[model samples]
Target: MKEEDIRELELRAILEASNDNIVIADGKGKVLRVSPNCYSIYGMKTEELVGKTADELEKMDVWSPSVTKRVLQDKKEVQVMQHTLTGRSVMATALPVFDEQGEMIRVISFSHDLTELRQIKEDYEELRAKMEYYQSEIQELRDKDQHMDGIVLKSKELSNVWQLIHRVAPSDATVVFLGESGVGKNVFARAIHDKSNRSKEAFIEVNCGAIPETLFESEMFGYEKGAFTGANKEGKPGLIELANKGTLFLDEVGELPLNLQAKLLKVIQEKKVTRIGGTQTKQIDFRIIASTNRDLQEMVREGKFREDLFYRLNVVPITILPLRERKDDLLQLCEFFLDMFNEKYKTDKVLHAATINEMLDYSWPGNVRELENLMERLVITTENRVIYPSALPFHTKESQSEVFELETEELPEQADNLQEALRDVEIRWLKRAYRQYKTTYEMADYLGISQSSVVRKLQKYGINS
Candidate 1:
């Protein structure tokens, strides 16, 4: 063959061997030829595409808004992203081939498949979002520095509780906390775990009342793959297993079902747990810290709670008084929560003197949690530099009336000497307040006196808790 024909043959072989789709068309946008790779790349046979115009391909629904037609109309190179009917993404580079007269003679195009790259990019973005979500949740769980700082301790009652915590936290003994709901039983559990030798390990907290009865066993003991319908295919570890070498805080333990209570007592005694629907038993080493607002002894008497489980769990009991019972901590707690809400909502609102007195005088049935929520509300809704009693959702007038009724009850019969008569009346009133309230701090708050004064009078009156 002649040298020009050989060169043409070599060029045709190179284009056919290329991985990208190569197409040659006349200046009128009629397809003259396409490389064999067009079938693999664009899902269209090269022979079928040959002699087909851009308008013909559009009518056949093979390609939308043909790049070759764009280059033909403008007589210039055009690069565009195209999606074929077969759901393949391609980058189409169409160039006009001009002769010496500066007029377009033919068009050549290359299509680079970008489907895999797009899929990879989408997968990366999805993974990044999942990582961020998990990271935030992990930070919320493990950030003890934030949690420890939030607890308020400003009274001798709480100071004594802290001393007890220090005494028992060094040991791996099971501790049971008794308190009203939202009184920070979980906080005390966390403090014990943080002070223990297993502080480096996970402190898994589970609410016995929160888990469903049907899922309680699976959640506590885990399950093997195909253990039951809808079970995880890869199997899962339970909260007990997760708490190995750490602390397992079971809040609202009094709410545990009788059957599960037996199972839990067994796990505590045996130090081993068997997964649901599996024969294998795993040995575990974890500390137990249980809390409940309910009286487990009363439940045991009524046969609602297992007596064996109660004795096993109640090795050492710590009673956390309600906020009304520790009124001295109220203002400090209010200030702490105010600071937290100020930082959270970016506000500088201060409490008015009347608002502080209203907070002090009112009986907080919801305890510290209520106060925290109130501070957040004031921070977000207060329109002035200071938060006033008018901003309170509850009526301070009604609360003041309740306080007055509690204090203004009729005094006992009088004595002979005027001073002696006053002292006798005061003692009777103090004794009545003590009987009415659950704690000395609460009596002091109701009588508008200090907790220390209440203690001193109780001591003088020979009163016992």
Candidate 2:
């Protein structure tokens, strides 16, 4: 065979074996040759396309916007995306071959199928959109968690209270929170205020009980300059006036004197406030949230609280359950407080399981406030990193007595001598008493011994309070 014929055969074999569709076109845009793979991309055999021009093939809907035609017109390399009649996507590139005279001689085009690539890209875009949407939803949940302000809604009672808060937060109706002294009434008041439309404005808090009866009027209602001897010279805005376009949190409203109850009611009814000694009335737009630990109805019956004022403030009443009733939240609350104070005080304290069990048994009379304080105290004062039951201030005698019984039950097996066993029993009881009582006087009273004897015994036993 001739050398030129062998090279021609090799070139044809290379073109037929290529994964891409190869096409050769004349400078005038006439197709001269096509690779065997042309059928897969353009859905046409090589022989059917060999004699056709790019314009004719485009007109036949084989592939739109031909790169070969673009290369012929521009006399340079060109690339384009083409859609085939066979429902395939392809990326085609064409380059012109020039002679020594710098005139274009031929255009060689190569096309790669892009149908699967396009589908994969589309799938990636869809997944990215979904991931972004989920991230935004998670961020929204985190924002809501920040607004919770350490409140644990594990119990059904608190969950119901939260539902009520959600139902009433959007409105401007007066909300009164009723609960025991440490049941987090103020915390609920703040939650509602934060969820309301006026969250961006000032939240003026007034402890009606903390303010004296003599100065309650002046403090609640602002006074003009020189209105009284001790009044601010530039005049002062009272709690009510300061709460304009915001929330007025009247904490312990039941302590308000009878004279001021009518006045507060008038302000709530009219949404206006006047200075203590001034006649000019200022129009106020504010939301009222009152919290109290007292029974206002009983006070009204006893002629202490005005019925009309009580009725006015009781538009939306929300009751918060004490901590003891919400026992499910105890462990979560303990962990929350531990994390908070540990971060605050730079400690790594953890609650022992026994301590948690003891906490579950105790009745928290002081409610969440007491628990919070106790956690803080334990975190600061505990010598070890783990907080145990012996570190807690409040423990029932029944629980401590169980420890005594367990210790005595093992005395016979553990003790060697009778005197040593009796001494061991005394030491254990004294230590138990020390753990149960805060002072030696209380321990002495419980043991029916003198205070001096209790101190001496505790000293001998090396027990420290």
Candidate 3:
């Protein structure tokens, strides 16, 4: 075959194989051929859209790329962004088709729908911001009162965590955040979305445990204007609808009622929802990130949670260590809370050494939220920053627990068996702390040492980490 005939066949093959919605426009901008993908990309049928002029397409918000116009004039490829008749956002790249004579005989363009990609990107960016700010804050938290997860530790465990987060921050995978209550799962969820591709979209949070069973469907799926007597006149959109093209976080998801579990499963599976009293199904493009304190697998066996959902959400599981595991960070939280309260109350005060010592001894059962409340209260109740043990709510408890501390107490210089006495003191302190706070990291803070140091000391004396 002649070189010219071979080039024509090559051009035909290129047009046929393109996955993008493609169209050809002669120099005068008349429609020549539209690719097969064009119908699917526009959510329309082909026969209904052939032989339309560029002006006719403009009525449906379709037009050649600005660059395409330049391409036609300059005989080059041009890219365009426009909305299709079906409302899908599209991007088009128009390449001028030439004959053997090198004259522009036609323009071939490829287009793609960017709705899902763009929405996910928006959600991702929003989640990334959350993760970035909080991840950075962990290193800077003040001592005494702070969220455990918000506190950064100089440990391989935490180093691994940061690395893992960075690895997983870019996708829309359903994440199952595993952590104890008050370990900041919700915060991490927000961070994931903020750091993700869906950052520009809305981030909706749903606490499954908080929504009652009878109203779960209506609350989550929404209802029409007259669906019920109390329904909004304009018909309320469900959380799913509100979160369209964004992120929907299910907090305490293990607590979701069983009757509604199937509904959630459908949404995750089909990516479509039918609001209450509404017949039409609306397709959604959103990412799911769920957090839970309860053991979902155990619940599945107990018939309280679904195993399928668990498997689906576990695509990416991030487990956060409890506050007790990161003892190196306790003082940082204390100072963070102290400064926060100081600024809020406009007080120029400092922590009393004795008061801090007492605080370290008491266990924080309620986690970060508990610590924050304590600091705020202490700051408000106390007259000065020179906080005395008496100013704290747990002072009496600490005094009572002083007996436990004596067992592991650091020996006095007056004692010849100093090391043994100090060992006893440490044991007593650890016991008292375990009884008060559920976390060992909290105990380590009370002793004012790295948690591993505590573990090592205890191990030397036959203690558990």
Per-prediction count of colliding residue pairs? 0, 0, 47
Residues 54-134 of candidate 1: C-alpha lDDT, one tens digit per residue = 879977767776889899888888999888878888999999999999878899989999999999999999999999999
Quote each prediction's TM-score.
0.55, 0.58, 0.54
Ranking by TM-score: 2, 1, 3
The 0-to-1 C-alpha lDDT of every candidate, in the order given, reads 0.85, 0.87, 0.73
Candidate 3, 88-204: lDDT as tens digits: 777777788788988887766667779788899989999999999987787456321123435444445655765676577688788888887876678778777777888889999
Which regions of candidate 2 are displaced past 4 Å? 1-147, 396-465
Q: How big is the positional error of residue 457 in model 2, measured in Å on the Cα after superposition?
A: 40
Model number with the top lDDT: 2
Worst 10 residues of 1 by lDDT: 400-409
How far out, in Å, is residue 137 in model 3? Answer: 15
Error of 1 at 42 (Å): 99
